[model samples]
Target chain A: MEMKSFLIIGMGSFGHHLCRSLAENECEIMVVDKDSEAVEDVLPLGVSGRVGDCTNIDVLRSFSIDLFDACFVCMGTNFKNSLQIASFLKELGAKKVYAKADEDIQAKFLKRNGADVVIYPEKNVAEQIAIAASSDNIFDCIPFVEDYYIAEIRPMERWLGRTVVDVNFRARYNLNIVAVKQGENVIPIPGPNYVFNEDEHIMVLGHINDIRRVAY
Target chain B: MEMKSFLIIGMGSFGHHLCRSLAENECEIMVVDKDSEAVEDVLPLGVSGRVGDCTNIDVLRSFSIDLFDACFVCMGTNFKNSLQIASFLKELGAKKVYAKADEDIQAKFLKRNGADVVIYPEKNVAEQIAIAASSDNIFDCIPFVEDYYIAEIRPMERWLGRTVVDVNFRARYNLNIVAVKQGENVIPIPGPNYVFNEDEHIMVLGHINDIRRVAY
Candidate 1:
């Protein structure tokens, strides 16, 4: 694999996590934060850091920002600082810029200014939590798309004796039973004749709406 | 709905977002951060705040932390401090504790120390980005389970004229189409007779492993 480099503009939660993830991916990462203490905290991760204000063009230029493969502007909440840093990264000709945004307005600012991708990590996590909260019966809720979810759900008592073919779950629930876990074993792609085991935990692929509609 | 109160330590991206989401759910919230600016920035949201070190048990005690229904520790990458704060939250009798981690080791520390839930936001984003990176044709990837993803992709040429019933996507690909977006129209549940439109964006739910097998 070819080596890549990144300049992370903050040491906040989102930026710190992204830096670690990129480091695990074997990228050369350099982090910057106005607080030298924050910079010092990340030093053990094998990533270099320096106390610098990313919003200043000179501070960014000192690090040769344009030469890095990408620049992560992770100051999501501060509108002025984030926008300034994003614009400067693009002006310096960074190959790609990824920014963190706290809201749709911030995302718009990042996109219009220069970000290649703008992510809202908080929103994503909250949405997942909301799904789990709403689907109380489901042990876990994994959002797939607008309405679809991949979830670990217990079959309603009425569903225990039916076989896959008898219910035609695909048509009835707009879902597929991808796997079933009976205690320690995972049954992937169970045959059509497979019965809904009362003691097993099934991985159901369907709309969250349909899953909510099931009468427990 | 029964309203709950929460104490959020570290007003970084993750905590700030979660705090906002919980506030929307009608929960009373109080936030803390060493950075006074961060605490000040979030005050407009109607949540109260105090500038203090979460690792300091006395500081936490001053806030009457145990009275809150739950607590969120969002100091990602600060292993020692995060562990201390999480342990202190439980010792103070907070009903639930959610902490943020940057890696497996940190997550383990949080779990062992007292965190009821430990989330890795960077890992979540990287997995989503990796799916998008690997499947160049897929526009979006939302993870549902260990191996499943909800993805949006352009229909293959062969699928353009076919109806859903004739294709039997679930059997053929271990996937289901939950919704489709054509221009401004979003079809939440396309009927069996629904034909794949060339201009539409189809939201497919399936195992990421199976989605990877698609020719497109």
Candidate 2:
């Protein structure tokens, strides 16, 4: 795959982590923030840097933001500034603009203003983590969509000493195991003959309802 | 499932959302925050409340915190205080301690200090959103583990008009579709003969490599 170019506006936690992940993937990143210290800290991480207020259209124009494939406005605490920044990014002809919000209402506002995607980091994490904690054997819950979930679930007492095929998981429970997580290692596309064990974690995909039936 | 009790240490965005989810799931909730206003907002969501610093062991003792099944520390931007609170919760005999961290270093620190699970809301959301933005067909990406991903993807030109059995997605691509999201409706465990439409998003589970093979 070709490298992606990203313009990250703000050096908050969301922007910082995004830059780090994109850098690890060999993407070219240009980061802007009002805090000089924040921009300086990320400079050594192979990202180009600038220090300026993101709400100003002139600052975005000076950076030639239109050249980037996507831009992220991660001003978590500043709703007004983030909205203005999102609108300005769209006006600058950026291909895609994503913004971070503290709550659901703010997400709707960002989406209405011009953000291609409005993200709520806190809500997303809380929902995933909360769902995981609620279930007895689910170590984590990742939503593929509203109906389907990718979950790390331990083998139930009834499922012990059984192979994946023996359980008739797909037909009986409307679920399928894609991988086995042994300790910290992930074994993907495990064979149907793979046996279930007490200590291992199985990663499965299914309707959230079917997942709960086996997970609990 | 029987009723589960949760004690939320801080009423920030993450805690507030988690509390709301737990309440909606019919769990008993006890929420505490130094800022009374933050606590007040979540009161209508069917949660009991207290106003105090969870970092102080005495404040926690007053609440009889050991009775709760789990506790969540959502004190954003206060690493030291959050870590201190996690330690206090464990010391008081809380079964599990979950914490929110802004960075990897903080996650390590929280884990060492009594947090059984350290969640990085920003990093988790950023990584998912970035992967979604990078791929043309991927509407969303959820990591099941380090190697496996569950992604909502639109069918590419090669996949258009093909039936599930015809494409042999499971055998050829090492992937399986769990659901089909058409407009606002979700069709879970979609039939094998279901036809692919350009407007619908199919949620599939596979290793990251396989997801990318189909994503682009």
Candidate 3:
């Protein structure tokens, strides 16, 4: 298979993680960072690492930016350097360019100036933490809509051996059970006759209130 | 402030992670698992541990299910047992119940049986991984529509010194810059004057095709 090529602008924590993930998945990676030590640290990871300023056009041109399938601006701190790199990538005719912005103003500028995608890692992590904190029983919460969510919740003690027909859950809670994950195995949308087990993880979907009610 | 209460039915990897995360946030937790060892393992983590069959009605009633704010039905392997638990929770008038289902049929059954939410862990994780792999520059991708997505892309070299107005990104790429997130900080909906730097993450909204065009 032809491996996809990627250019990562920063070699910070997020960048390092992304690089490792992609590399493990067989993607060809080219990394750039201003810090020589950072580049050296990742050299053995088998990715093409360059110690150079990502904001410099000459440094980018040296790598033949057009050959890359995509570019990831992983710089998470300085807003100015991010924009410069984004503009440079677009002007170079790279197929796609992604940048990380620290502030709303920087994000807007990147978008308006040709950055294809901008990410906010801190907000996403915080939201995940907040959601986990707010609901006591919810193991993991994924939003389906503003009011609706899919959550992994611990089963209440009362639900030990009753069948679906016995509960008439639809009429009462207005929720949906999507699937069940058991250990490494997955049961795709179990049948009505399926019996509940003690070590199973049930996947559910419904309104926040309804889910919270069952979760609590 | 009154802390919320939670009940975790299964003591698997997901359950363990959930319990630890919630407990860290100061939520009260009750853990129920068939394996005595599993319950004992997490006892020191500050969670109430109970070794009992989740499918038992007597066990369900003994937990004072009414007091729990929500419940997580983590049992996914045994569909029959999961269904029983879902119905039991509903019968007990637990405010909300969440389950992890491996199959679509299981989800349907859990929903029909009063489970407020159903989750498919494999499916969710698979989709997340797929998105991350599809785009070289995209570190994260959130789907807003079937054809549209919000992606976080790293900046490229060319865009280092330009402003939003100078680039005219919207007219060129049909992408929206929503926000930027720096390390531990978030700037929502940045404006034109905002500048881009090398070390920032920006949030952009656009169709997948457009996003790909700009990001890569």
Model 1 spans > 4 angstroms off: A1-97, A103-105, A130-216, B34-51, B61-67
My TM-score estimates for the predictions, one after another, are 0.68, 0.87, 0.50
| Ranking according to DockQ, highest score first | 2, 1, 3
CAPRI-wise, candidate 2 is acceptable
Look at candidate 3 and tell me the lDDT of residue B109.
91
Q: What range of 10 consecutive residues in model 1 chain A has the weakest lDDT sum?
A: A127-136
lDDT, candidate 1, at A30: 89
What C-alpha lDDT does candidate 3 achieve relative to the native structure?
0.70
In model 1 chain B, the worst 10-residue window by lDDT is B127-136
Rank list by TM-score: 2, 1, 3
Docking class of 3: incorrect
- Steric collisions counted per model: 0, 0, 131
**Greater-lDDT candidate between 1 and 3:** 1
Q: Report lDDT per candidate.
A: 0.75, 0.84, 0.70
Query: Candidate 3, which segments miss by more than 4 Å at Cα?
Result: A102-106, A143-149, A170-172, A181-186, A196-199, A206-210, B1-131, B134-216
